[model samples]
Each structure stands twice: as structure tokens, then as C-alpha cells.
Target chain A: MQVELQLFATLRKYAPDQPLDKGLVMNVEPPLTVSILLEKAGVPLDKVKIIMVNNRHAGFDQELAAGDRVAAFPPVAGG
Target chain B: MTERYARQLNLPHWTPETQQHLAAARVLVVGAGGLGSAVLPYLVAAGIGLTGIVEDDRVDLTNLQRQVLYDTQDIGVPKAEAASRRLAALNPDVEIRSHRTRLEPGNAAAILAGYDLVVDCTDNSAARELLNRTCLNLEKPWIHAAVSEYFGQVTTLLPGGPCWQCLSGTGAPADPPPAGILGPVAGLIGSVQATEALKQLTGTGRLLVERLLVWDALLPGWAEFSYRRNPDCWACGRG
Candidate 1:
């Protein structure tokens, strides 16, 4: 399945050649959970502020079907 | 009646009844910095009856990167006062109130008493928690937005939805890494906050509700996460 992935802040370094700072995007196996996808991408899930599936909110265990757009935000410490 | 809101009156499904509801709504926004700077003008211009701004910090040159409400001449002045002045000028028909004090548990309830809704634009977790606790008790809806560098997140909390603590939990995470935002990024999140406020105020469309809207302007895309009220949340549990 193709699940769109977005990485925030320093995590953008994972995909350096990309035009922008968003993290890498990859095609993962079927039934992707947010935690598993992040783990597969080598993103530290603990650093995430929250994850959004499509335009609605989803928890870590929420399943990602085909064509799910996933964007992850790291904790924002900046004022 | 729609003529009063003739400009936005053409915007989508919003109607005169919604405009009337907005004219009768009251909202309180904490911290007049980046998020508040972007949130205030739009809410006032949209004709929210009474909008209150509370902040104790004064403008510093460093804030110019994102705090759009203040100009060079306004530096050294209090944030709430400067913001109130500009917001008032932006829309004289809407009432603007300024409270130049830090938000603490003691005065939180009193300050939040009359407003129909609140916006949490404060930077720190401690203050954010306080606002959450206060609103949770009062059952007031609030929009929460936080930014660090290039990324930011937003969510809307109705009376029973998941709250800030439900997501962050009791023990605060260690200070996040050094993250600063591009000016437009803050503007974008703040604008979303403003739009959410308008939605809640006018009852026109579905709100962000239990979902978290996170965005990275660098990638310039949005991700949403669904959250439920934690059965054991100290602030908004099944009490």
C-alpha cells in the first residue's frame, strides 16, 4: 500500500535530497499502523507531537488503508 | 442582517443566522504572540462580539520573526495592550478587552467565566495545562495551537472531546529539540485557529474536534490524528 508520510523538524534529514524539509515517503506493506510506519521509516515515535490520518485524527494503532496521507509533527518546543 | 457581514457573507455555507450567532459570541485568547497575533484580527474582523486578550509579556525584537501584531514603535509595550489597540483599530464594532497578567489557576476560572470559547496560544506546557484544566472544569471549548520551528499542530476541544493532557499525559515530555518556525508557518496555523473559532462561533461547519491537525510548512501538508478522551485523564476523565 502507498501511505504518504511526513516528518517534522530534524527528522527531515532522513530524506536529504527531497526538495523540501518533509520527511521521506515510502510504500509499506498492507495494514500499516502509525507506530509501525514510523518504525519502518526509522522515525522515533516518541518525538512525535501527534499524527494525522487524512484530515481526521488517528491514534497509533489506527490502521492505514490504501491512499492514507500521514503527516507527523514532532513536539514543538519553540515559542 | 447579512449585509452587515456582506464580505464574508459570500463565503461558502455561512448564513445570516450564523453571522448573528457570531455577533453574539464571546471568546478569550491567551497570549498575544504568534498564534494570538494571527488568531485575534480574524476573529475580530469576523465580528465575534467580545474578544479578550490576556498576556503579561512585552514585545521584544526577537518576536518580530512571527508576532505580526506589533511594529517597531510598539516594542517595550505590554503584549495584551498592544494587541488590544490594534485589534480595536481593526474592528471598532467588536469589543476588545485586555488583561495584562499571567494566567494562573487562582484567577483562571474568574477570567474565563463569561466567554463562550477560548483559544490557547500560550507557549509552555504548564500554562497550557492550566488553561486546559480551567476550560475542562468550565466546559468551555478552546482551540490549542503550538509551534516549533517549521512544524505546528492544532486541535479543537468541545466539552467531552480529548484534551491536551489526554495527548501529552501527566508527565511532561523533556523539552523538545530546538525548533523555530518560518513566519508564514505561524501565520498559517494561527489562521486555521481563527477559522476554527469562526466555525465554532457561527455553527456553520464541523470543527477539528477530536482530531489533531499537524502541519509542516516545509512539506506544506497536513496530518490528522484521532484521539479519544482518556478514561483516566486527571483533567477531563469520566467524572
Candidate 2:
């Protein structure tokens, strides 16, 4: 299964040499959880404060299906 | 309506009645930094009856880049006071109150209780979360905007609707890397917040409620994504 991973703000640093918005495509086995994907992508779980799956908020334990679009954002603390 | 608002009144949506509605509305803007600098002037110029600015930080030399409400002369002065003075001079018809204090859970409710609406212009997540809980508890509608470098996001959280917690959850992350924000990005998001406030107050046009509008200057475009109320959301959940 392949999933698209998008990152925003500081989390963009975790993207694998690709356009952050365009996202990176990663292949993983079935029964992938958000936490597992973040670990595989080397994005520290603590670094991601917001997770959007298919543009909807999802929890760390949420299961990911094939071809899911996941967006992760770190907390932005400036005005 | 006075001759001052004549230009806005000429617009198709804004009539003398909408001007009157603006004059009767009260709003609280929670931060006197980048976004507030842009949000305050527009809200005052549009004639919100009473505008409360809550900020505790004193202006620093570093703030002039985007906190347009202050100047080099304002460096060392409290931001709330500096902003109040400047905004008042822009429009004396609109009343401006400066609450020069940091907003926390203990004081958030009292500071926010009377306003008809709130604009969450705070830079940090803790303040944003506090405003969300307080507004939810008060049943007041508030607009939330955040800017990081060239990216910005804006959303409106009405009572019983999707909220900040529903989007980001309740936990605050440990201090992440410092954010890099461009001046115009703040201005853009702040202007959008002011526009949302006016529409919310006058009961005109579509509100951004339940929708998060994300703008990326690099992409030079906007992508709006809809979010639903989380049944387990700590702020506005059924449980």
C-alpha cells in the first residue's frame, strides 16, 4: 500500500527531499497506524501536534488505508 | 452612519443599517502582535462599538518587522497601550480599551465575558487553547488565525461547532522551533480575521465556520478543508 505524506511548518524538514506540499509517497504494509507511519518517516511523534488524514483530524492510533493522504503539522508559536 | 464611513456604506453589502450594526458590536482581540496590528486598525475603522485589546508584552526592537501597530518610538512601551493609542487616533468614534495583561485560564473568562466576539491572534498554542475553551464556555464566536513563515491558516469556531481542540486536540506540544513569519503574511491573515469579524457581527455573507482556510505564499494559493466536531474533543465534544 502507498500513502502520500504531507508536512507543514517545521515538520516540512522531515519530508524526504521532495516538495513539502506535493508530499512524498511511501509504501507500507497493511494495518498501518499514524504513529507507525510517523516513526517510519523519522518524524518524531512529539514533533507532530496536528494530524490530518484526508483533511480530517485523526488520532495517532487511527488506522490508515491504502492511498491515504496524511498531513502533519508542528505547533506554530508565533504571531 | 457618519460621513467617515461613507465609502464603505456605498458598497452593495454595507448599508447604513450594517454600519449601525457594526457600531453596536463589541469585540475582543487577544494579542497585540503581528496579526493584531493588522486586525485592530480595520476593526476600528469599520466602527466596532468597543474593541478590547489584551496583551502583556512590551514592544521590542524585534517586533517592528510585523507588529505594525507599534513603531521604534514604541519600543519599551506596553503593546496594549501603544496599540490603543494608535487605534484611537485612527478612529475616535470607536472606543478602544487596553488590557495590558497576559491571558490565562484564571483570567480568560472575565476578560472575555462581555464581548460579542473574539479574535484569537495570540502566537502560542496555550493562549489559543485557552481562548477556545473560554469562548466555548461563554458561547461566543471567535475567529482563529495563525501565521508561520509564509504559511497561514484561519478558521472560525462558533458555539457548538468544530473548535481548535477538535482540530489540534487538547495537549500542547513542547516548545517547537521558533516560527518565521513574513510581515505581509500576518497582514493577510489578520485582514481575513477582520473580515470574518465584520461578517459575523453584521450577519452578512458566509462564515468560515467548520472550515480551515490554509494559505501558502510559496504555493500562492488557498486550500480550504472542512473539519467536523470531534465527539471526543475536550473543548466542544458531546462527551
**Highest DockQ, which number?**
2
Candidate 1, residues A1-79, lDDT tens digits: the string is 8777866665666545645744355789877788899788777776665566775545678799878877665556444
TM-score against native, each model: 0.82, 0.93
Please give, for residues A1-79, the per-residue lDDT of candidate 2 as tens digits: 9998887767777765847348778999988999899898999898877788898777788899998988777776667
The TM-score obtained for chain B by all candidates, in the order given, is 0.94, 0.96
After superposition, the stretches of candidate 1 with alpha carbons farther than 4 Å from their true spots are A1-6, A13-46, A49-72, A77-79, B1-4
Tens digits of per-residue lDDT for model 1, B135-228? 8899999999888777788889888788887876623356665466688778888999999998888776889988777777666677667777
- The best candidate in terms of TM-score: 2
Q: Chain A structural similarity (TM-score) per candidate?
A: 0.81, 0.93
Q: Positional deviation of B186 in candidate 2, in angstroms?
A: 1.4
List candidate 2 segments past 4 Å from native: B170-172
